[model samples]
Target: MGERRSTSQSLVSWTRLRPYAMISPAILVFCLFFIYPIGYMVYLSFHDWNFVSPTKEFIGTANFTYLLSNLEFREVIVNSFIYTFFTVFLTIGISLLLALWLNRGGAIYSFLQASIFSPHITSLVSVSMLWMWIMDADYGLLNWALNLIGIESIPWLTSPDYALTSLIMVAVWKGIGFNTLVFIAGLQSIPKDLYEAAELDHTPPWRRFLRITVPMLSPTLFFLTIIGIINSFQVFETINLMTEGGPINSTNTFVYYIYQYGFQFFKIGYASAAGVILLVILSVLTVIYFKVLSKKVHYR
Candidate 1:
């Protein structure tokens, strides 16, 4: 009997390990591609060395110190925060509304879901081009529409005043789909019984949503919020292609700044420092958000 018990335990251990074994390749791939690059970037952050330089000098904290003192860097950091805040909030909130609508269960549900999600799969460069055309003052569809409505043409891509808003609009349009899908999943995950219970208690729709839906969806909301913030901070492609950080760097995001510093200006060491700062900031914010908000999430 003891021998049989020992054999059973061994089998259970193997069963658990087998699944992990299957994923070992994936684990190795991530470590190689993701972790290794990030680790190397961190190591590179401290040095006053570009790969092109004859000798790489380890400057300790000088690169970081220099970056911190740059006014442009500070402005870019503030822009990162502002963009992240607005993008995340707007994306998640609008997505929740659309998700609620899509969760109502009908032909309209499927249609709206498909339509909204279609843009997500579209090419980013193409979307940027399309928005650029739409925002053009003289020959653009938007301006034509505005003229029809007797509204003044707004300088979307050209003017510093409207550049950031145009970018935000594009981002919101692109991001709403994925967040909506997440919300849809979260909404559907709630047990029908809970809503029935709420109904039994004569819970108003708004109260039920606030009390039941909000709590249960907290985990999904929290996850989307983090992801949205991360993506917003890393925004580069649209801004780079559309504005080119023009009109006084009004739309200069952190990642774009990194690209300009490293590739454009060949200040690889300085850019590495900027990247390290962003990594530290993101890591801290993610930890704080999860700590404060995670416990409040109701899986029900």
Candidate 2:
């Protein structure tokens, strides 16, 4: 009897430990790839070293200090904020409207959804190249269309005034499909009974939407806002391929600035410092968003 009890205890112990053992490989990979690289980046932020340098010199905040004082870096930071603001605001707003318009489950709606989402899944390089041709000042489809409407050709990608706007438009076009899908899911999840009751009570359509749709979709909106802000701050591919941060550096954002410093100029430490600053800024923004906006989110 005592031997049997000991074997049962061992079996129970193994059962309790098995799940952790199963997940150990995933945990190891996460630490090795994600956590280690972040830690290394932070460590490198304090030292001055070119990629080809033999030894790194301890700069101890000099990189951060220089960036803070530099006008170009300051402009990059401001541009990042501007780009993120417009992209997130416009993407979420437009996506919500699209979701509302096509919330019905049907073949037509599905086809439209797929059509919108195709641009998102399409390669960024391909999309950028396509837009470059479309936005060409001379002999481009867009200019040709404008001429049909008796409007003169506008320099979409060449002028400083229009370059950032063009970038924002591309980002919005790419992001709207995903946001729309998320909103559609949120909208569909809402109970039909609420709308029926509102209708029975003679509630107007706009009021019903305001009271029912917006409140219920708050959680979805909150989630999309956070994600959009993060993505917009990391705007690199479009800027790199389309404008190359040209037209008086009007579209030069934080990530592009980092690439220029690290890869182009070989100021590894400065770039790392910029990276660390970006991480800190994102962290703070996320925290603030949760603290201030999360209370308004309706989980159900």
Candidate 3:
């Protein structure tokens, strides 16, 4: 009887191990690609080394100290925060409004959805090139339109004051479609009966929307907020292709700064420190979002 019981226990243990065995390949890939690289980056952040140098000198936290004290780095940090806030805010706000307007089922709505989402599927490089031509100060489409409206041409990408705003506009336009689709999904998931009941009670449209639609859509909004903020922090491609962090570094975001240090200057250790700083910033923001804002989110 004891032998039989021991056999049963062993079988149960093997059954439990099967799931872990099945996921072992994924675990290995995660460690190899994600965990190991992060660990190496953290280790590299403590040293001072050019990518070409064979010797990595242990300089402790001097890299971080320099970044904190550097005025240019401080400007980069400020630019990163402003870019992230406006991009996320405009993306979510416009997408929500669009979703609300077009949530009803119809052929025209379907066409509009497809048209709005087309930009998202399009290549960023191509979009950036197209926008550059359109935004050209000399005889560009935008300037021509402005002239017709009796307004002078504005330098969208050339002026330091307008460079970052131009990038934000592009980012918001590119991201609006995906978030709109998500909001549409969230809108559809809401029970129609609630709206019907509200209508039967003669609830004002605005009040119903404020009470029902907003509450039900809180989960979607929360999700988009988190994702949008993270993606905004990593803004690089548009800045790289269009502005090159130029107009006297007006658009020099954190990721672009990392690229400058790592590839342009070949200061791998300094770049690693910047990357680590970015990671910490993201982690803290995520935590704060969850702790402070998540309570208002309706998970259902």
Number of the top-ranking candidate, with lDDT as the measure: 3
| Candidate 3, 36-147: lDDT as tens digits | 9999999999999999888999999999999999999999999999999999999999999999998999999999999999899999898898889888989678889999
All candidates: TM-score: 0.89, 0.94, 0.96
CA-RMSD of model 2:
1.8
Where is model 2 poorest over a 10-residue stretch in terms of lDDT? 242-251
Residues 27-132 of candidate 1 have per-residue lDDT tens digits of 9999999999899888888887766888778888888998999988888887788778888899888999999988977887788898999889999999999998
Comparing 1 with 3 on lDDT, the higher-scoring candidate is 3
Candidate 2 clashes between residue pairs 3 or more apart in a chain or in different chains: none
Cα RMSD (angstroms) for every candidate in the order listed = 3.6, 1.8, 1.4
Give the candidate number with the greatest TM-score: 3
Clashing residue pairs for model 3: none
Ten residues in a row with the worst lDDT in model 3? Answer: 133-142
Off by over 4 Å in 2: 1-16
- Candidate 1 residues lying further than 4 Å off, grouped into runs, are 1-24
- Which residue pairs collide, candidate 1? none
lDDT of 2 by residue, 261-295 (tens): 99999999999999999999999999999999999
In terms of TM-score, how similar is model 1 to the real structure?
0.89
lDDT of 3: 0.94
Q: Each model's number of backbone clashes?
A: 0, 0, 0
